[model samples]
Target: AQSVAQPEDQVNVAEGNPLTVKCTYSVSGNPYLFWYVQYPNRGLQFLLKYITGDNLIKGSYGFEAEFNKSQTSFHLKKPSALVSDSALYFCAVRDLTDKLIFGTGTRLQVFP
Candidate 1:
């Protein structure tokens, strides 16, 4: 079965600094990876995705990810961090069944 792993349970960053949430995936074939962010009381919001395109893909709210097939990794990144960006970030991959297999979410705490 395909799976994703978010090694860090929590990530702390000061406001105005850059941030990154690590993600690694395992699948049988070409992987379709995605990044989502969840706010305090809101549903998961789409951030970005990597699906047979340029290695670097950008998405909503000043976010982006790099598709590194050789490393089997797709780490989320932002040029600068904001306190409002604090939320639970998830890394997922499309499985053979077309279902999203999500990793243990990483909580991003952006401090002021």
Candidate 2:
């Protein structure tokens, strides 16, 4: 079975401050990790993905993530946050079946 858990229901961050949204996963095999952002009434937008290779992967809007195999975690980070960055975030894992299992969803509120 594959699953993801985002412990936090919401993360409060300030503009220009570094922000992180924690995520953990359990999968049967090597997982394909992905981060997606969603604004109100909009579909999710791909931020980044970690298929294979580097432990540190960078993505859109100056966001990046680190894959820790031992811990089975993939945490999203940003050196500087923005008010516009405030939105809903979802961490997902794709197994051999190529089906994405998403977290409950985390809301990031970035205050300016």
Which segments of candidate 1 are over 4 A away from where they belong? none
lDDT of 2 by residue, 1-112 (tens): 8999999999999899999999999988788999999999999999999989999999999999999999999999999999999999999998667789999999999999
Q: What TM-score goes with each of the models?
A: 0.97, 0.97
Candidate 1 contains a number of clashing pairs equal to 0
Model 2: lDDT of residue 57: 99
Considering only N, C-alpha and C atoms within 3 Å, which residue pairs clash in candidate 2?
none
